[model samples]
Every structure is written in structure tokens, then in C-alpha cells.
Target chain A: MSHQFYSIECIIPPHIQNNIAEKGTPEQRKKVMGSISQSAAIRAQRVLLTETKALVEPVTVGGKQRNIFNLNFGSNLPGILARSEGAPPTGDPAVDEAYEGAGATYDLYQQEYQRESIDGKGMRLDSTVHYMKGYDNAFWNGRQMVYGDGDEDLPEPQRIFNRFTIALDIIGHELTHGVTQFEAGLVYRDQSGALNESFSDVFGSLVKQRQRNQTAAEADWIIGEGLLSPNINGIGIRSMKAPGTAYNDPLLGKDPQPAHMSDYKTIDYDNGGVHINSGIPNHAFYATAMEMGGYAWQKAGQIWYVTLRDRLTSTSVFADAAQQTYLVAGNLFGGGSLEQQAVRAGWQAVGIQIDAGDSGGNGGGTGGDTGSGGGTTSPGCSTALVQLLDNVKALIENRSR
Target chain B: MKISYRRTGGFAGMLISHSFDTDTLPKTDAEELVKLVSAADFFALPSKITATGADQFQYTLTVETAEQQHTLEVGETSAPENLRPLLEKLRLLARGKPDL
Candidate 1:
């Protein structure tokens, strides 16, 4: 909790936002800028809040606790309480969708990974819908998720984005950011940053696939499906099976994700291509899952979860992640087993080589040998979020002064 | 004085840029922009902003004044409050330039 953890995983990348700003009509440009400004403002506020000691304590809540908030087109965090856990659907599409999406994500981590909630300690899941006027993005702003209406006010054909909460994978994707905050705490820049993004995409897709009961072969492997407005000439934002093939619209441009390290982008934009280069490891996970030939969440997801929770450090790069997952796989499925081989193949496909000698407890240099169990029980999380709610209230009060 | 702003990074890996000489802008607006830029103290800002993994925009601003030339890379969220108007003006002026 003492370590500052803040990241915003926007469903729409900033390049797309910049493109829309340039290519869209006056109104569309305003909407996209609104989204960008909102994001910037939230980040600025988050940096200030995280520096305060009062906001960094963690609180444990038993079972699934979700709170869906209604922003009503105003810029506010955790807006009016629309619904709480076990509440009846209010017939409000945004509220209901947010509620249901959070539930499904919670179920996935709890049922599949045996973790309680995003923090593995039953941390409360909070979301805000209808954030700001004409906002066009959804993001996990460190503490909670906030979604926009996706330019709904515009007429058909002109609208470029659907409601942020419409796609369940988007919800799963944002929530996984929270889990990453609690777990690996990966430094959100360069290669480490991409791994953080890939983990979210990997689990986000699994949440959608598992909900549909689709096998690895049956899954589409696309993140943010149904997120773009109908007029856009793209299926989704990013494709896992095929990284750069997701979208190619006149305004949004082509997806620039690289499936291999050779094509990795090293620029400082998008936090060293966190969203772009994630395609490398994302493809790795898909390949590993397909090779195993069953439910991806079963073995593939388990290997990733263990690697992320127990092995990864804040500075882990792609090679570090590959090594940890390979070692974790050997422990979970036995050394030289098919599952372990699949893990090796996954990293190799991404042009990252896992040293065969660095097997079973030899990797993840910060930790000790994980032994034959392969799975290490993640340690209990410290205080960070529960104290945030209290600190935010104080901040709001101070702002009014 | 000539000023240029280049924006890079984001989801799509695209770059957008625009530049204008102070001699071209309206006298009053140019004066306001010069004052704003001076107030922002761009040279004093940190080299990198916070390390959050959002699809943030990075702006490289180049100023060619009679005295000297200076360039700095700034995260979108890290720009000082006094510099907001200048950044917005640059982006507004950059509109309609065909994407490169």
C-alpha cells in the first residue's frame, strides 16, 4: 500500500483519440477531447491522492462486494450509488450492465483462480457509468473503474464508440488492472508495462470465453469486441490470435500491435508501447492455450495467475515473465509435461526464449524455490484501497475550501 | 520566434505535428502565447512524468527564439497549468493537417 499504484487502462487508446480528434466532425472532436481531458484530470488527481498516507490502506471485505455508481454525465468519482451487491436490476442499462459485468469478473477470478476478489482478499468492486459529457473511454483509475457512454448522443453512423460497459471483456479487462495493482505491481512502463496490459487482456478474454463456455479453439480471442460503433470498419480493438488484425478504420487507423519481439516498438508513447507490444505476449498465451486444446482458463490462466501473483516483480520484463510462467508451468503440470511444453512454446512463439536450465524455482530471482507444488499461495495484501474512500472524501472536502 | 509541437505515442503508434512562426500569428495572440510559454517554465519541468501505464500523449515542444532553441518531452498530464492554453492552441492549429 505504501507503494504508489496508479494506471488507467483505457478501452480506446490515445492514438485512436488523436485520430478521431483530427478526422471527426466538430462534435466528434469535442467528445474525444472530453474523454482525453477527463483521463488527464483523473490521473493528476490520482497522483496527488496516492502520495497521501491516509489513502493507501487496504481493507478486507468478505465475499463479492460490488458497488455500481451513476455519474449521470457529471465528472465525479464513484458517483451516486445506483446499486449494491444483490440489488435488483434497476432497468437502467448502464447500471445493470456495469453490475452484471463486475459480477462475472468476480466469479471468474474466484472460481478459476481461487482468489477472493481483485485483491484476492475480497476487495470491493466499484464502477461509475455515464462519466462526463460525451466521454468516449472506459478506464480503471487505480482505485475503481469508470466508463463513458461512448458518444451515445450522436446520431447513427456518426457515433464511433459504443457504451463502455457494453462489452463484458472490457469490464474484465479493467478489473484485471486492479488485480495487477495488487499482484505483480509491474512498473507500468516499457516491457513491464506491456506485460501488465497482456495479463489484463488474457484474463479479460478468458472471462468472456468462459461466460460463453467456449473452448480455446472456439474462442474468438478478441478484446473489446462490440466496443466500436457499428459504422467503424473493424471487428474489435485488438486481436489475440492475430495481433495487428483487430481494427483498421479511416479515423482509428490500423492496429499496430506486434506479435513478436523483433517488431516491438521502443518509443516512449503509450508508456513504451504497453498496449502495442502486449500483442507479443498475448499471442503467446493464445498459442499456449490452443496447444493445450481445452478451456484456456483451466491451465493457461492458472499458469499466468501463479506467475503473476507469486513470481513477478515490479521490474519484470517479457523475458522475466516468460521464465516465471515456464517455471510455474513445470511446477503445476510437472517438469517436461505437455503443459510445461505448451508454456515454453507460448514464450518461444513471441520470440522470447525461456532458458531450459532455469526450470522449477530457479527463475523469479526475488523469491525462493516454489518447490513441486508449482503454485505458490499469494501473500495477504496490505492496506491501500479501503482507506482510499475515506481519503477521497477528505480530498473532496479540501477541494471545496 | 518559431514554435513546433510534435505528439507521439498512444494506442495506434501514430505521430501528429504542427508548427508556426510567431511572425504569422495575430499580434495579440502571439504575445499571449509567448507570455504563457514563459510562465510555464518548460525547461524546469521533469524529464518524465508519473509512471502510470495509461495510453498517455507525449508532447515534444520546440521553441526557436532569437536567443536560443530548446526542446522538451512532456507527458500530456504533466504540463503545467499555465501551459494549458499554449498546448491547446498548438493542437487547435494542428487540426486538418493530413496524418503522416
Candidate 2:
């Protein structure tokens, strides 16, 4: 057994060992650990050699690796590998589109946000296209992307949708759901679900904008642009800039998204209106980006990304999103800076008021214009300290109540 | 026997519905529908089956017989294996309808 353990180190490559460490069963992982410990000096030398090689050669580590599959109009996932990373186009529109879409989505997160991939650990992106005949939807499925061909089987005059992979933002949107799953794990119901949907739309639109080199003002802010069929009286599935106006066709009914909290729909279906109410926060993001007046990804996108990655929880509501984005903007820029003010105005435009108490104690208050910049006077207290004091005060108030 | 199905909350956020009475169909089709419903043990299913994921479809299915009627709401991920064939049949039937 001791000889076998030493032999294991010689046989298995370091990359395979890393993979086993991450995904192997507990017993297997323990065995791998023992082998690693027994061969520390050899492993160190190997690591140094690998690092030296990497320094001299171009590295693909933490880079995008996409796998596109053809479902062949079947329901089974990843039915057949149509394209792999760095592969040439297959001439099949669905396969090629899925391939390109995944790459573009990967680029958005990797280039703009410094996120390695959907899981923030260079997880390989897998997408299956042509899922089920005339299937009119796409989804993240908690693991990989699944896209339907839409009403392609229907007669041209009656078709209501194009292929699910037609829109780059839709691909970005579904991929961002994977990001949200790895991050906040927002429950797929009620307000948290709406926030989940909103985050997808926010990042999805940003992906398209960055790819197009569009400024905040130049971008259309549509979630599923060009996805609807030509006969349909719709530009897209939903509009972040103008939520309820995305579509209004006799066949598809109307887009029911509301732009403000005052108009929030309390419906029984659609998971407490997750898709519907997402418009509020979507518009809020649009407003924030518009106010910031540059590439939306620069400030507005960073604030939302940090908030989603750090501050928001599974059960966070609209108010929590507003508050956290404001705090994150303040933290990233400066307290009461233009970016923070833009976030505040964005949420305010959507009828969600960030609690003044939360921002008052941001502590890095460079702007003396804010009336409640009391935390700025206390230079000894850090922002975290001020936040702690606020939490304590809130706890006392809740207890008394 | 009467059956109705509504699907909501996909990535596109579109709503689709289809309803039909077995009596209106040919005898063979009606019998097949009855067989599918019976095979699914529709009445035995819980009123709601919950699932967690983003942008998956939610289905509302109602079946009516001479004596009783039952409605079940299920998410796509949580939909039981037995229930899927019936859902698939209904989804195919719903295609090409004006409201789809």
C-alpha cells in the first residue's frame, strides 16, 4: 500500500490531481492528499517547473472553455458534442450561434468584471442548442445553458419567436443566472426571484453593450432583442429602459413589466411575478447607467457586480438591493460620490428608497454636502465600525418594538 | 373528461394555454387521453410541486372527470416523470393555437 501511494504520485499528473482534489469522492480525495503529502519535495519542484514554463509560454489557465452541443430537437441534455473550445464553426446555425454566444458571454465576465467564468473559478461553459422541436424558451438549468429553436417548425406566418440563441443578451442573461446561482443563490420566488431576474438582465444588457462598444446612451437596454419573430409586434421580450413596452402583440398578449415599485404586480403565477417585477430593478439599472454617462460597465456595472457578489443574500428584497448597491458604490468610489448618488437616484427612480441611515454612516465621506455625514466627523471609526454601530442600534430598536 | 394546461415563466416570460374536452375528439384520441391521464395518476399528485432554478417554466394542469376535478401546479425541474408525457402531449397540442 505504501509503494502504491508513492507510485500514484508518479502516475497522476498535477492537473489531474487538482481535478481529483476538487471533484473526487472523499475517499479518493483522501488518498490523493496522502500521495501529495508523501511527495511534497517532488511536487514543489514540479510546481516551480510548471510556473517557469508558464512564464515563458502563453497560459490558458483560467481562460474560457466552451462546449456546444446539439440536442437534435430532443429533450436530453448535451446530446452530442457539436463544437468544443477553439473549434471551427460547424456550419449549423444553432451550433455556431451557441458557440459564439457562450464565448461572448465568457468574454463579458472575464474581461469586464475579472470573473474567471460563471462560477468565478474558470468553470467550463456548456450550452446545448436545438433543444426540443419548436421549443420556445431557453434556461440555465442550474448547470449549463439550454436553448430552444423557437417556433421554427410552425408556418412562417404564424411563428411568434425566432431561435432562442438569436439574441446575444439572451445568452448573457441565461449565463448570468448561473453566476447568480453561484453567488447569492437567490430563491426563485417573490422579491428575491425578481432580483435574480433583474441581475441577469442587468449583466445581460451590459454584455451586449460592451460587445457593441455602445455607451450607456447608445444601448437599447432590451433583454431579448430580435428574438421575437418578424410578424410579432415586438422589438424584444422585455426592455430595461422601458419595461412594459417591449412587446404588445395580439398573440403574445403584452409585456406586463412595471417600471416602478408603485406599479408592482402581485400575481399568483410566474413565481410571484419574478419576470414581471424584475422590470423595476432593470429600469433602476438603466437609470443608473444613464446618469453615470459612460460605458455602463465601468461604474454602474461594477457596483451591481460587487453587491451581488458580496452584500446581497438569498432572501434580499428590492430595498436590500438598493441599499447594498448604494453602499457598494460608496465603498468602491467614495462616500456620497457621484457614483453613489447615481445609485441612489436610480433606486429612487424606481420607487425604492435606500435607507438614509445606511448611507449616512459610510464613513469615507469626502462630500460634506450630505446633511447626515456625521460618520465623517468620527475619523477614528472605520466604515465597518460605523456599520456595526448602526446594526446594534437597529437591533435595539427592533427589540423595543 | 376535460383537460386544461397553462405554461408560464420561461426565459421569454410568455404564457401559453390549451384546453380541450375528450368528448369533442375522436373516440380513439379520447381513449388515448383517458389512458394518459390514468397512467399519470393525476389525482394522486400533490397540489404543488416546488423547484428552485431561474427562468424555468411553471405549469398549471387541471383535469376534470365526471365525478371530480383536480389541479396541480409544478415547476419544470420538479415535474414528476409520470407527468411529463401528458405535459408533452398537451404542449404539442397547444402548438399552432392563435394564443400560443
Candidate 3:
């Protein structure tokens, strides 16, 4: 049989894009130049290897999902082993990872939420494994997911045993992108994008916690805990339980996620660093899990999942998501259920409160302007928030008027 | 000379910069094809076949993350015309902005 294959690269890694985007000095520009140089050398070498490989025929009768090419995970560049139907990973570590990851995601959706494939229409799952030479990341594009073998400086082979590279949680985290895409399609910009990322982390962590038989209290609630490459900075890429504490590395700097709304970063990049500012809702979920004191999947995951599916808008923002989840929690478990209360407390912990109007509390948008009950974290917002509040007020008034 | 194609900078995933080190005719042809297809991502001047080492003409392409500004290098011992399909894939990836 012949094989058809394709390669996908990761989101901008720590070095090139982050550096160039953040800095404006000559020295920083030099570093960008150097990265460009190194990239050129690697690409040249990569082209040579792929050139010699013969075209691989597809094993499946129908084309591989959306296209006619088959993508199999392997060490060979541009190696196409088989198509998307029942394509078990064939002893290739990368393939195995992709296969297993897909399985876990599929299982999670079916078992937990009863959702269909990425599009809720049994869309054939497609993935490319062993994507690039020493590439150090994995990400889901709009259509499919791609994995990198990682670089020598990072984790070689990018392999994880119990925790390192092979963590099922991370797999779930990446795959949730598909779920988000199909559902809320949260715009990846400003607060909305951050909310989108938060939803992914919340659900991603729950998928792992539920699978591993860990209670919400017991789970670490970190996105890529053990998968952090040995030489990199920080413990993982992100932490739901503790936002900014994920890492403190020299080269990669630190995990910059702020857990509270007051500290929210309004700067718009990486679609508002959806991954970075996601820490806010992540913390909200963590707090909800803590207050609920049970398996997170039972209450917390269900709440986020349902809201993600039903309540949240495609362009939902952090506050919008928070408000929607609060309403959903009440609907799922009743207004006075512990689930709803925990939802309120959770959002409050992140310096977000269900509007008195939304909650049917004291009304007049009054009572407590109080942000948090008792948490070390504070919202990252500022006097600018007042302006935002004014804008929101005008919006409400305009709509009402 | 051996050659391959590497791609990088799309979504929130791995960075790809692939190549095969070799001195072969088909390999060189693959590189040439890729260059021809990737007109949008190239610099000025036609790719010159320079014998950098051995009897191989190095065809180089640099792709930076459109959103992240990360750069990845992909090249081959062949000319760019031989690597059309691979180059097309990279072009598609760099075209749109990823949500996260």
C-alpha cells in the first residue's frame, strides 16, 4: 500500500516569536536573527531527507478524512503509513501517542458528555505525527492535530513515560481544541480568547482527573505537569490551581498567567495570549472544584461542558462565560444546589461575581461590590475596569433604551 | 545529496523545520519544486544552485510564525522546484491565524 503524509508545526515556541514580539532592542533582534539562521539550517536538512522517500499509498479505500493523502506517525519525514480509519499506531512512538491521545479524547467525549466527534458529526479524526526535526511543541490547527518530535535542547524524542511526554492529560488538553472549535468557537482575542483557553484547561484537567480516579481536591489541576521538558523553565506550561506558579525558568522566563480578574492582561496578542490569561477562569474552575469537594468531572466538568456546549456564545468573553456558567450550574443542579453555590463562589474567587441582576440577589447591581471572599489572589483589572464597566453599562443601557 | 522539507509556526503545537542531507537527482528535483510552489514566502533573486558541499545544490527556505514571529528553517540539496506539495502545506498553515 502507498502512504500520504503531511507535517504540522507547533505554535510559536519560546524563542523566536515571543522574543521578537516582546522586545525592541538590537540585542533582541540579534537573537531573532540567530533563531532564523538555525531554522534555515534545519529546514535544509529536512528537505534532503524527505526528497528521497517514495510516495506512500493509502491503506483505506476512502481518502484520509478530508483529503486523499494518508498521514501516519513515524520517524521518516513525509512518511504516510495509512489512513484515518482504525489506523492503530504501528509501533511508532509518535503514532502510538497520537493514537492513544485520540482514543482518550474520543472516550472522554462519549463517556462524559455524550458528544460526537470534533464537529459533532463523526468527523474522521486526522493527525500528523513526528512532524518536524527537533520541533518542540504540539497543537491543534482548525482541522487536525500535529505533534513535534521536540529538539535536542528540549526533550529528545519528546517522549514521556508516566509523566514526561506521555501524559494523557496533555493529550486531552490539546484535543479539547477540537471540542471548543465545534462548540463555542470562542473568538481567540482579548478576553474572549482568554475565556476560550480557560474552558480548554478546565475541561482538559477534568478529563484527566476523571480518568485517573482523582478527586477534584486530589488533582493538581495543572495542564502539562510532568510533560515539561527536562531542560525547560517552569514545572509545566500552565497551572489551573496556581496560575503564575507554573514555572520560573531562566530562558523561558516565567509562567505569566494571572489567576484573578483584577490582574487580567488586556494586551491583545496570541489572540490575547488566550493561553496566558486563561489562568483566570482556570482558577475559577479550581475554586469551584474545591468548594464542591467531589470528583471535578461530576459537577465542575459537567458545568463547563454544558455551558461550553449550550450557553456560551461563539465570541463569549470571560465575564460572559462566567455569567453563563453560573446560570447553567443553577439550571443543572437547581438554584439552591451546592453546585450553583460553588459556581458563584468560584467566579467570585477570580474576582468575578454573578450580576445581582443575573443572580436575582439584592438587585440595583448593589449589595457587595466585594470582589473576593478570602483568596491570596486579586483580580488584575485596574481603573481601566471602571471604563470597561462604563462601556458595559452603556451597552446595557443602549440595548435597554 | 539528501534533502527534505520542514515547516513551522502555525498553531499552538510543535515547530517543524525538516530536511534530508543527500546528493541525489530526485532529491534535488524535489527541492526545486518546493521553491517554485512557494512564491509568496521567498526573498528576491532566483535560487542559485551553489555547491556548498559535495555535489549538492542547497535550496533553502525560511518560514517564520505569521503570528508568533518564530522562524523555522527548511532546505534541501535539491532545487526548490522539487518540493512543491510540501511548500504548499506550509503556505496554507501560515495563511491563517490560530485561535490560541
Candidate 4:
């Protein structure tokens, strides 16, 4: 707990490095350059630290009463060293970052949720630094989380505007997986899987925001923006502020995530494209929060947390999830509360329904859903759409790692 | 002893390989290991994903060093303690695909 966590960062995929290398703006270039330098320094430092020996002591300061360490156990990667809890980071920035990220995630949950651990069961949090030497990805592998140094394989990776580095959002995103496993345990495929992912995104972003001590309004609302290696012509991991706006570089192609159900791409990866299709719900939360302004955690965070706890199930579909939130809004906030109305309206904006017909009004599901159905000419359509979009974004961002 | 393994293409196009020396394994033990590893389904590669398979895993592996046999399975688990989970993750360069 005493070791400074930010001293290290995970390996950045070469592709992410390439993306940052191509940015037109000098500031962006500088930021990427600095991040690269810092990340490399941390990595080098970790190597030296690993060879040295130091005892890690307990930290009981600030709002953190519990003792949690940078706790990712490398997913048994070859030649990787599994770090013990509270162990001093081996002067490696990447290792330090992983440890720090894990500590931050653990603290976020312990401080905010009153949860004991990722399992709410005091599960030991273990992490490995210098994973894969130069891996480019990170994820929560059911038992534990592991990080990669870089994604050396993908063509779009190295030369892209944004490169891979284990940033806060990615860390936050993976940690939320444990929360999801305990709570709704959303199936890892299709709509449920997407919901699972959405929750992580929500809390993941919140973790970063909380760490910076930034109010919801003051937050950047972009996840993983600073995490990528400076090479891609894009933003961060995924844009919650502007769902599809995270990346627009030619090499990486579009973000591939659609903001609405009408545009949901039903792929087979991550269980019916859970990861890819998640953009729909992720956007919905963003839209909801923007509509309901102010510090999202106060009103919007509470509402989403309640719904996730009480209203959501492992197999809930988007429409079902929408309706559940709508129902929760009325029950928790009172009948016809602004929360309920907003929740219902939010779903509609995303081609979903909260108890009634399709988002296309009465057109029904599987019908080329869009605003072509017409709302009988109402001036509120655009405004409502924008608000809902923002609300969805906020909700999802709150749940990020 | 010869075992067959076909790991999904990784970021490096390199195969995740493991070798060990086991002279104590009985013939049935070896058969069981192969059955167990292949049945572990650690990778969970979805059919539609041409780029990469599902990284989530609960995998196991039983490589007979003396026999030169290896087995790997992705997705679905036949046993909770089976080696599939750990082996599956080891194959993934700590890059967070799925858990073991």
C-alpha cells in the first residue's frame, strides 16, 4: 500500500504507439511522447526493483480503511512473476501501474460500495508485472485479472493513431468484471453480456473520475483517452462521452460500436457480440446522465446502481433492462418521478422500450427502427434524444474499472 | 505418446507451447489427461470470430514430456480443478482475453 502505484505502466501494443505517432496536433504528440517515456521508464525500473528486495507495509490513510494491494495475478503467462499483496513495486513503471491500478480498483470498490473484495468474499488480489514483456491488452480473466504489454499482432495496432497501454480506464473496466460477477452475473454473451460490459464501463470511468477528484461536470468523460500509445489518430479506449467518437482513424476503422439498437451489430464474439454490441447500452447511460446533469454519482449513479442491483438479471435483454430501470425509477424515486420518465425516454431514444411497444413508437421490433416513424411532429425530439444520449453515457461511465 | 493441439492464432502468430517430463503417468492416466484437456474448452472460440477467438477460459493441460503428448481445449469446463483454466490463460500472454 505504501509503494507509489503510478511509477509503472503496462507494455503498450506497438500499434497504439504508431497511432499516437501520427497525430496532427503537437500537444497530442507531446502527451503521447511523455506517456511513452514514463511508461518505458517504469518498465525499466520494475526490472531493477524485481531484483531488489523490500518489505511492503500496510497503508491505512485517507478514506481507505482496508488494506488491498496492486492485486492482478498475471494469468499464468510464461516467465511472468506473480506479485504478493503490499509488495513494493520493482521500480518498474508498468509493474507499478498494474499494482497501482489494482490498488485503485480495490479501493474504489471497498470505499464506495462497502464491498469486501471483488468477490465480496475477501478473495486475495494478486497481480503480475511485466506481463508478456510487450503485451498490448488487459482483461479480467474470471479468476483474476491480467495485463499485456502490447498487442504486437494486429495490423491496425502498432501504426495506428492510438497505441495500447494499461491505462486507468482499462484497469477500471477489468475490475468491474468482478463486480458484475457478484451482482447480476450477466451472461457473457449477447444482450446480457453487453450489459455486463456496460456496467464495467460505467464504474470504470467513475474510478478514474473519483481518483482525479473531478466532479462529473469537470470530468473529461472519455475512457482510456490517455492510455493508448501515441500513434493512432483517435481518442482513448472507448468514448463514453461520445460513444462512437472514441476513434476515427483510417487504419483502426470505426469504433464498430453503434450507439443505438437499430445499429446494434449482432456478432458472435463475446457471446453474440457482447463486447461489440455494448455500445448501445453504453451510449444510453451516457445520454441519461447528460440529460440529468450535475454530479452523476448523486442522482444518476444511485439510480443505475439500484437498477443494477434490483432490476437487472443475468439474462435481461436490452428492452427488458430498459423496462427494469424504468420500473425501478418509479419504485425507488416514486411514481411518475423525473427519474422514471427520463429512464423511459432514454430507452426510447436508443430504439428500446420500457414497458410498451418498440423504440420506433408502435412500429415494433425487427422493423428498420429509426425516427422515420415520426413522433407526430414534436419539437422535443432532438432535445430529448441528446439528453438521453448523455444520460446513457454517464451511467456507463460510472461503472468503469 | 503423441498428443494433438491446435491453439488459436495469437497476437504474435506464435503457438503457446508447454513441455514436461512425466514418467509416472499410467496409460489410462495419459488418456484421461488428453480427454480432460481437450474437454476443458479454455479458449471458447466462437465460430463467427475470424479475427480472434473468445479469450475467456477455464482450461487444463496435460503434456507428457517423455511421451511428447499435449492436449488443449477451449470453452466449457469438464472439471473445476482441471488444468484447462490455467493452461488456457498461460497461452494468452497475460493480455486479458478470458480467465482461466
Tens-digit per-residue lDDT, A1-401, candidate 1: 21112111111112223222443677876576445433333333544543341236344577999899998876546689999999999999989989999999999999888999877667789889997655556777667888878767667767777887888888898899888877667767777788888998999899999999999999999988887887888888899999999988776678888998899887755667788889999999999999999999999999999877766655667776787788678666655668888999988988988766534532222221323223321121112232334455666787779
Chain A vs. true chain A, TM-score per model, equals: 0.77, 0.77, 0.67, 0.64
Q: Give the per-residue lDDT digits (tens) of candidate 4, residues A1-401.
A: 21111001111211122223342376665455344433333333332332221112122133322222232333333234534455665665656676677677777677765665555555555444434323444555554455555543445444322222356766667767766665555666677777887877777777777788776667777766665445656666577666677765544455566788888885533456666667788777767776666666555666676666544545556755676565445444544556656777766778886542212221222222222332322343344434434544654465463
Cα-based lDDT for every prediction: 0.72, 0.77, 0.53, 0.50
DockQ of each: 0.11, 0.43, 0.05, 0.05
Per model, the share of native interface contacts recovered reads 0.12, 0.56, 0.03, 0.02
Estimated TM-score for each candidate: 0.70, 0.79, 0.59, 0.57
Give one digit per residue, the lDDT tens place, for model 2 in A1-401.
23222222222122223222434577776575444332333333333443343344222346888889898887767689989999999999888888888888888788878998877777778889998777888988767889998888888888888998989998889999988877766778888889999999999888899989999999999888888888999999999999999998877778889999999999877888899999999999999999999999889999999878755656667876887788677666765788888999999999988754434223345452242333322222233334434554664575579
Go through the candidates in order and give the C-alpha RMSD of each one to the true structure. Answer: 14.2, 14.3, 17.4, 19.4
Model 1 vs. true fold: TM: 0.70
User: Lowest-scoring 10 consecutive residues by lDDT in candidate 2 chain A?
Assistant: A7-16
**Best-matching candidate per lDDT:** 2
* Model 1 residue A313 distance off true place after TM-score fit, in angstroms: 0.5
- As a whole number from 0 to 100, the lDDT of residue A101 in candidate 2 is 83
State the lDDT at A375 in candidate 1.
34
Question: What docking class should model 4 receive?
Answer: incorrect
Measured by C-alpha RMSD in angstroms, how accurate is candidate 4? 19.4
Q: Candidate 2: lDDT of A361?
A: 22
Task: Report the TM-score for the A-chain of model 3.
Answer: 0.67
Instruction: Tell me, by DockQ, which candidate is best.
Output: 2
